[model samples]
Target: MPKVSKWLRRWSLQLRWMFRYFLQWRLRHISDRQLVIGVSVLLGLGVGLVASFLLFTTRWISSLLAETPFGWLSSLYFIFPIIGILLVRTYVRFWFQGKFQKGMAYVLYGISKRQGNFEGYHRYAHVLTSAVTVGLGGSAGLEAPTVLTGASWGGFFARLFRLDSAYRVILAACGAAAGIAAVFGTPIGGVVFALEVLMANVHANFIVPLLISATASTLISRMLVEHELLTPREGLPAFDYVHLPFLVLLGILCGLIAAYFMWMSKQMTQWELREKKNGNRLFWEELFLLGALILFLPPLYGEGFEWLDAMINHHEMAYLQRSWWGHWLPAEWGIALLMFLVLMLKPLATWLTISSGGNGGAFAPTLFLGGTTGYLMAYVANHVLHFPVELPATMFTLIGMAATMAAYFHAPLTAIFMIAELSGGYHYFVPLMLITAIAYATKVIIQPVSAIQAAAQKIGAYLPADKDKAILNNISIKHVLERDCVPVPYEGSLRDLVDAIARSRRNIFPVVDKDGYLKGIILLDDVRSIIFKPALYDKVAIAELVHAPPAVVDIHESMEEVMEKFDATGAWNLPVVDEGRYRGFLSKSNILSVYRKRLRWQIEHFG
Candidate 1:
């Protein structure tokens, strides 16, 4: 009876072992390229579908709310200005509670820290509040919410997969790219934008997956929704050789415009800070005042979306052609003057939205504001200056979009690519590049860090100067390698070799001669072959069965270099030796575990 019980137990153990063997075999063959491609495809599909649905949903809600009998609820647009104020206040109030202070800042933090984890509930709250604020007519765009949603999803998935810090950051960037692509229907723009804005560094290793995901998302979004949020300009003439001087002038004007916006945004935040300190006003109360201001400003009251629609359709309004409210005021200077004013105010609107706690993205608003400014400027140059340059207002608008975005976000390449994607060609590359260069240089001269970087610094989170090299070198094989030594004699039988290898936490074992000198390594395959041919198993020594010249690494070498060596040799496990003696072994699982843990720590603490 006891023998029968032992036999049953042995059979169960054998079954478990075989199951594990099959699982490992399956995992061993799964290539990293295949995993990256598969993940990219899935992410792209999800981002595309979600972005398109959201775009349509936002549009439908805005239209329905405007047309309803309660369409006076459209007066709710007045509330957006205040809502924007409230959004900024909420972010500021909660700034010290975590490492990430704002949505964009959080994304950047995740990338720099290599841990993208954010408080899901808190992030959801921010999104809901912002959405309500913007939907009711907050003078903000929807891109911010979209980006936050995508970033949160990426962070969640990275954690779930137990990805390393580098991969986690890359995935988060991919998420942002996917969201942008889906929302704008510009895959190339999204890809470049992610690299420029979210990732501090760009490497070839990350480009493939990022681009693939962005393209997939864009395609998916197109299938779901047919409308383009920001349509391309129509009826624009190609650049002429005579337009070179005018283009340079336009670039200079864009730089100045970008600088003005940056200044206004900074001032608005400073004003809010002062008001909060002196008046002791709560966020909601300040929001009410902001709403009242909007209600009083006749042009701003019900005209926000109207103006946006006009800009989109290339229709210039008489009022916009004549006036400047604060800096360029009075309504008589014509289209050129209005353009300058709008250019100056674009940053103000963006700042207001962020400050008021309005839920929306600066991306779309920046484009809208920049385009309007450019149109006005171009109109002035042609009609007022009589430069004989027929440069379209749309072209100026596009340039303004790129310039303003480049200045504030510090992503010139992204700005250029995004404009090209939106405009549908590289026809304006020279002008766009020139404008981007000017804007970037101007911003750098005035402010060394971008708003996103500023927000990160406020929360005590900043990218290390040599972070990549430090992380790679810091991960040493000595820190993660398995030290449990279970050596097999060269003269040992095949059965003995199999048992010894099985007892260890690996499939490979080092074989030693009688004098403790290292012979070679015997892998599971060699054991299996010997087992299949019973004659060999019975007659051959372990030395005969072992594979010669085992791949080995020193105990003190960096795990990164060890990994590279393993990759080059296609070895899953390598023996760790010190001087002339074999210490133990290292496997991919050990390195992977260390990386996963490091990433988790960064996310939980920094994100």
Candidate 2:
């Protein structure tokens, strides 16, 4: 063992030395921009390979625990999920300070506020926990974890090279793009997903680097990933114009389903119930309940991609019907009913595990919901309405998956492109777009925000493009309000008031009583005429010069409300009242300065 350890360390040092020389040589010949793209390509390749490994490992774990030799234990495979959850909860509570982050929302938050600078633990936390969660039968996907891993790696690479904040954000985005591209094996879709869902800003310069990274990652993962998520099946249905109208209906149904899922997720946010009565001691109680649900509905286990494959491929469907669990069912109708029931329960199962703190993502669930919804819709039209060969459920299944993804994500372009690449052509482009647009429109009418956006909002962050709003929302009035304004005592004479104004640079001053309670404001503009009249200046008291402010800003109020106050009052500044006491003054200028700084940073890093 000692000899092996020594040999491994010596070999690692030699490889590092060689890689350093190679990078140095490459940097010397390339421009800074070219070098960045080159680094992005390599990063994409690495991310793709890692994503493929994660996909295969999780798939292998699922089969090893649930199939053949363990078929007798099929009833207990659900227990494996419990063990996985407990392990994850334990690791997070003890080793990771109890912060079991589960998705790419945190990465988006980081990009918005910290220029993509984030903690190191995030890179491995998702990989380990998500692998365990999906591997052991938790109803989630590896996409989110892979995205986080790639993003963290990109951040680390930027840090290693001491790259500027702007470069760091771009690189982090590149890594994320590569991960998605590799995982789904859809380069264009991956690039658009990164830009639309993760990046704070989209620009012309970003396109080339993202393209380079996404293409490289997809190619690399194609070589490493097994017959899993990224591997497109052969003999997928060709597009038939006769199915276009049905595709539209499928898209609308997807939108409605997305809305229902979002609403259900909100209802399942039962942290308030968990925190009732006492402290958050022995937290993870919900995991056990979620475990029981998976036990009853075996189809909820993992990402449900296997079911999706079966829905589109008849051979796979027939094979599923012949499995140990399937043999108990009556016949064709029995297996079909089981499939339908699984589809119906999938959303609820995902809600239970994920909302309860399981480490995973909704990428797979949304796809599953869409595919099943599409397939079921096709089944109804063909079997019930007797539509002959005019429609195939498999064709609608493909469109349905894209529609659901587009609606839930509110990313029609990404969905369309991803579906196109996944199915290996633009054959269904017309219907894909038609369905994606209708679904997105329906989603907008139902819920204005996507699940991803809503999740990030809990941390006071919004989607990447709304950086200014996110910053304003996260910072409180106490942090940015001007606290250095001069104050005049109500009892003070004009002489005293003038002395206070002369010494202070501010144009607005607050009038306070002896008890430090706010009375009114005295603006330099309002007092200018009085100050010039020598007779009134020395004779008048501060109280006579006082003018009531149009409005008062509360420290606890949101920046949006505060800005509205500024607009309604038409005042340059307003007094900040906290608990009915004058704390400071808030001005439009001060808020604008902070906003400009944040906006400038966002543009530099993401634009």
The number of the candidate with the highest TM-score is 2
Winning candidate number (lDDT): 2
The CA root-mean-square deviation of candidate 2, after full C-alpha superposition on the true structure, stands at: 5.8
Q: Give candidate 2's TM-score.
A: 0.78
Off by over 4 Å in 2: 1-39, 49-53, 66-71, 155-167, 199-201, 227-234, 270-285, 315-329, 380-386, 466-499, 509-565, 574-607
**TM per prediction:** 0.65, 0.78
Per-residue lDDT tens digits for candidate 1, residues 275-298, read 888987655654665565444332
| Clashes per model (N, Cα, C within 3 A) | 17, 0
